[model samples]
Target: MMNMITDMKFLNFFKITACLVGIGVATSACAAGSSVLKIEEEKKVPKIQTIKKRDTASVAILGDSLAVGLYIGLTHLARKNEKLKVQKYSRVNTGLVRYDRYDWSKAAKKISQTDDSNIYILMFGANDLQSIRENSKAYHFQSKGWVKHYNERIDEITNAVKKPGREVFWVGLPIVGKSNFADGYQYLNDMFRARAKLNGITYIDSWDWFANSNGKFQMSGETADGKKRLLRAKDKVHFTPAGYADLGVRVAKEMQISN
Candidate 1:
């Protein structure tokens, strides 16, 4: 439970800080009248604080490298939105149910125990596609039994974190690669949407930004000013910095000030 919450949590900083800027004065060794243009006084950058937010709202992200927000772009988003309490737990390379992989249960336990009322954001499945199952060598999604087990484990995670005044959001996977994986991606996305609906969790569709009118992944994304630009990284599996910014802003907008 804690894993789910911590994984998606982001911090919000509302306080501003002041800094002093000094204009370059002539060094004793230089011409005394020569001076370089510089800031000559202390100034405070007004805090661009998180909007009025619920004291308890939080997010936890879980999944593979994508969920972890690798690359410079994702790191920038995290730095910019530190106040949102968005925790992330993505392994370098893995998916939802690797046989020896870490599960959300461990983290979920901590979040569930917290006294604060908050929301969770779950981002899993990248690794699950080929993850080995518990007590066996078989991978997840290979059989009905395994799928059922996978879904049940998800439920267990939710149950552990269940409480009044709390909420959840599940972000579905986007299409990736250029082959059979595309079909698999769509299937998993469909399952994710269904699971989110059944569990009464908020579902964020990566496809909305990733897909085209014909339902295939769109390599470019719409910018704030409406310009379309390539948003995915070279791998075409993840987003660029601007892409993360777009996603983060959209999320902030959807949450609607949380309070």
Candidate 2:
């Protein structure tokens, strides 16, 4: 009888121990699940904060001399708008075709890494009507090889400036007095437009803005006040102060409309 009683006691002790072990395992599982859920919740907060941080408009103007004029105009506009900021990174007589003189691709990448501006305005191709040298061979302007290489350079600049939550605006070259120059500028504009579309950026067409009613190059145009003023410089390549201011106004209007 005593032996049977001892056996019963052993069975009861085993049942108690098993119940305690089951409770401990359930508690530990719940704690581990809670920790995993907490970690997942923490991971989602930073992305939301990063998106919110990039909501302001800061303009970064880059390119050749034409871009310098546009930057002047934007600088003036920014003075009136407290929220707007404008910065320039342009060089005279520089284009993608002449890499030996000025390597715009490398310059653009460097600028993008350093500048915190969310908006980029680029205007080039004014001086690109030359030969491109690659692999010790020269590709003359308008040739298939030239076009291919020039388009790649465009892609390089576009990719360099493009970032999440950033906007890019490529200003097309305006009409020139010289027929040959105008033809080349038109071709460059076509390429710029196509690449801008493919890269999902904005292309500002300045051709019509500076052209006369007959759609030809004109030295003068009407200002915001509707006053007839000289817009083009003597060389017919660069713009006068008034011309750049008008161009700036056009770009400013675009920025406002986009917002």
Candidate 3:
């Protein structure tokens, strides 16, 4: 009878050990499955990409009366963007031709040395339709000598503003109300364009922007909001406040700072 009791006790102990081993195996399998599922879920997640924003532009506007108008317009447009900064260095009745009154090449060199601006906008040729004196010799407008000297002046101004990280933009004259003035301006625009290209500087042409469908001058034009407004002053050479604002919009677009 003792032998029978011993056999029964051994059988019961064996069954308990087998049951414990099965439970441990089941637990280990569940943990392994959960680990694999977690790894797969991690793989399915998308990676996030970062995008960079454009840098701010510090603009310096230098020219004649038209540049003054451009400064006003850019100021108004820049009011909305804190990243854009514009400074005007324009004078009335001043241009590249008359060194006796104001030397733009000297002024540009001075600005380049003193200012921290990255962009320079040059608008002249309004008061430059006159004669240019060199070595006490007069070179009349449209003369070969005058053209050569004017082109050299353009180069001087362009080189003055063009630094290691600076950009230069030469703004061409727009159409005037008087046909004679308009023709003169067209001649000047060609020179400005050629010189700008030769110097690797950008030239902003304002002729077509202010002209009618027939390529003639127009007094009224559409603004940014698509409304017709008087763009030119009564003098027909300079821009009205609204006209300048429109020009500002176009320039801002070129600078890639437009809202």
Candidate 4:
């Protein structure tokens, strides 16, 4: 009877030890599974796209039909720089000489007040070849009185658009295929260059690009790469896309260099 009681106690003790070992193994397996799940959760976390801050410049294009052409090229060029912003304010067949139709000074001042622009591009004198309305009378183009009145109008427009931190670039008129129109544009370019210098504005001379070696206007012009291409349209007043592209690239390069 004593031997049987002792053997029973030993078997009971062995059974208890096996139960403890099984519990420990299960607990260790559960802990390992939990560690694996935590690693997977970290891997499933999404990555976010972040935009970097860049240098920026605000540009305003102000003028007539020629300005519209310039704006097309300028806008294309500005997009090359992710930070460049371009605003266009162009009037078709409008100029400083024709204030009765559309006053440039008032328009410029309004636009300047509306936006904070660092660069201002001025291109005009296309429709200024016609007669100007001054003091309740019409003055013929190229006349002494007409020139004087036009100069005053130019000064008014230039001064009105200026702000504290704005830099102005006055682009000269390009040569037209018509001799009479070319003459008018040449005279206007002279006035533009002189007034721009007087008002502390940079003048961009576009005549040489459109003019041939003989200093005459040509429908086909050489690009920056010296490849001859059709740059002018049939009307001779506006530029072809290729012409604007070439000019726009050059202008953009100059703008970058200026800074």
Alpha-carbon RMSD, each predicted model? 23.5, 16.6, 24.0, 27.5
Model 4 error, position 206 (Å): 0.8
Give the per-residue lDDT of model 2 (tens digit) for 125-147: 98899999998899999999999
- Ordering by TM-score: 3, 2, 4, 1
Q: Which candidate is the best by lDDT?
A: 3
The positional error of residue 170 in candidate 4, measured at the CA in angstroms, is 0.4
Model 4, span 36-92: residue lDDT tens:
557766675432212122367677888998888888887776667667788889878
Per-model C-alpha lDDT, please? 0.57, 0.81, 0.82, 0.77
lDDT by residue (tens digit), candidate 3, 1-259: 9999999767545544545465444555555555655776667543221111235888899999888889999998888888889998988888888888898999989998998787888998888888999999999999999999999998898888887667778889988998768888999999998778767777788888888879878899877678899999998888898999899988877666746
Q: Give the C-alpha miss distance for residue 184 in model 3, angstroms.
A: 1.0
- Assess every candidate by TM-score: 0.66, 0.76, 0.77, 0.74
Candidate 3 lDDT score at position 237 = 88
Poorest stretch of ten by lDDT in candidate 2: 46-55
Q: Which segments of model 3 are wrong by more than 4 Å? A: 1-55
Query: Number of the top candidate by TM-score?
Result: 3
lDDT of 1 by residue, 1-259 (tens): 8876665332101111111123343243122222111221112222121233453345655556766662233344445555556555546665557535566676567756863536555666766665446665564565776777777766666566656566665667766755656666677787777666666566678766666677666678675447687777777777777766666655555555231
User: Any idea what lDDT model 2 has?
Assistant: 0.81
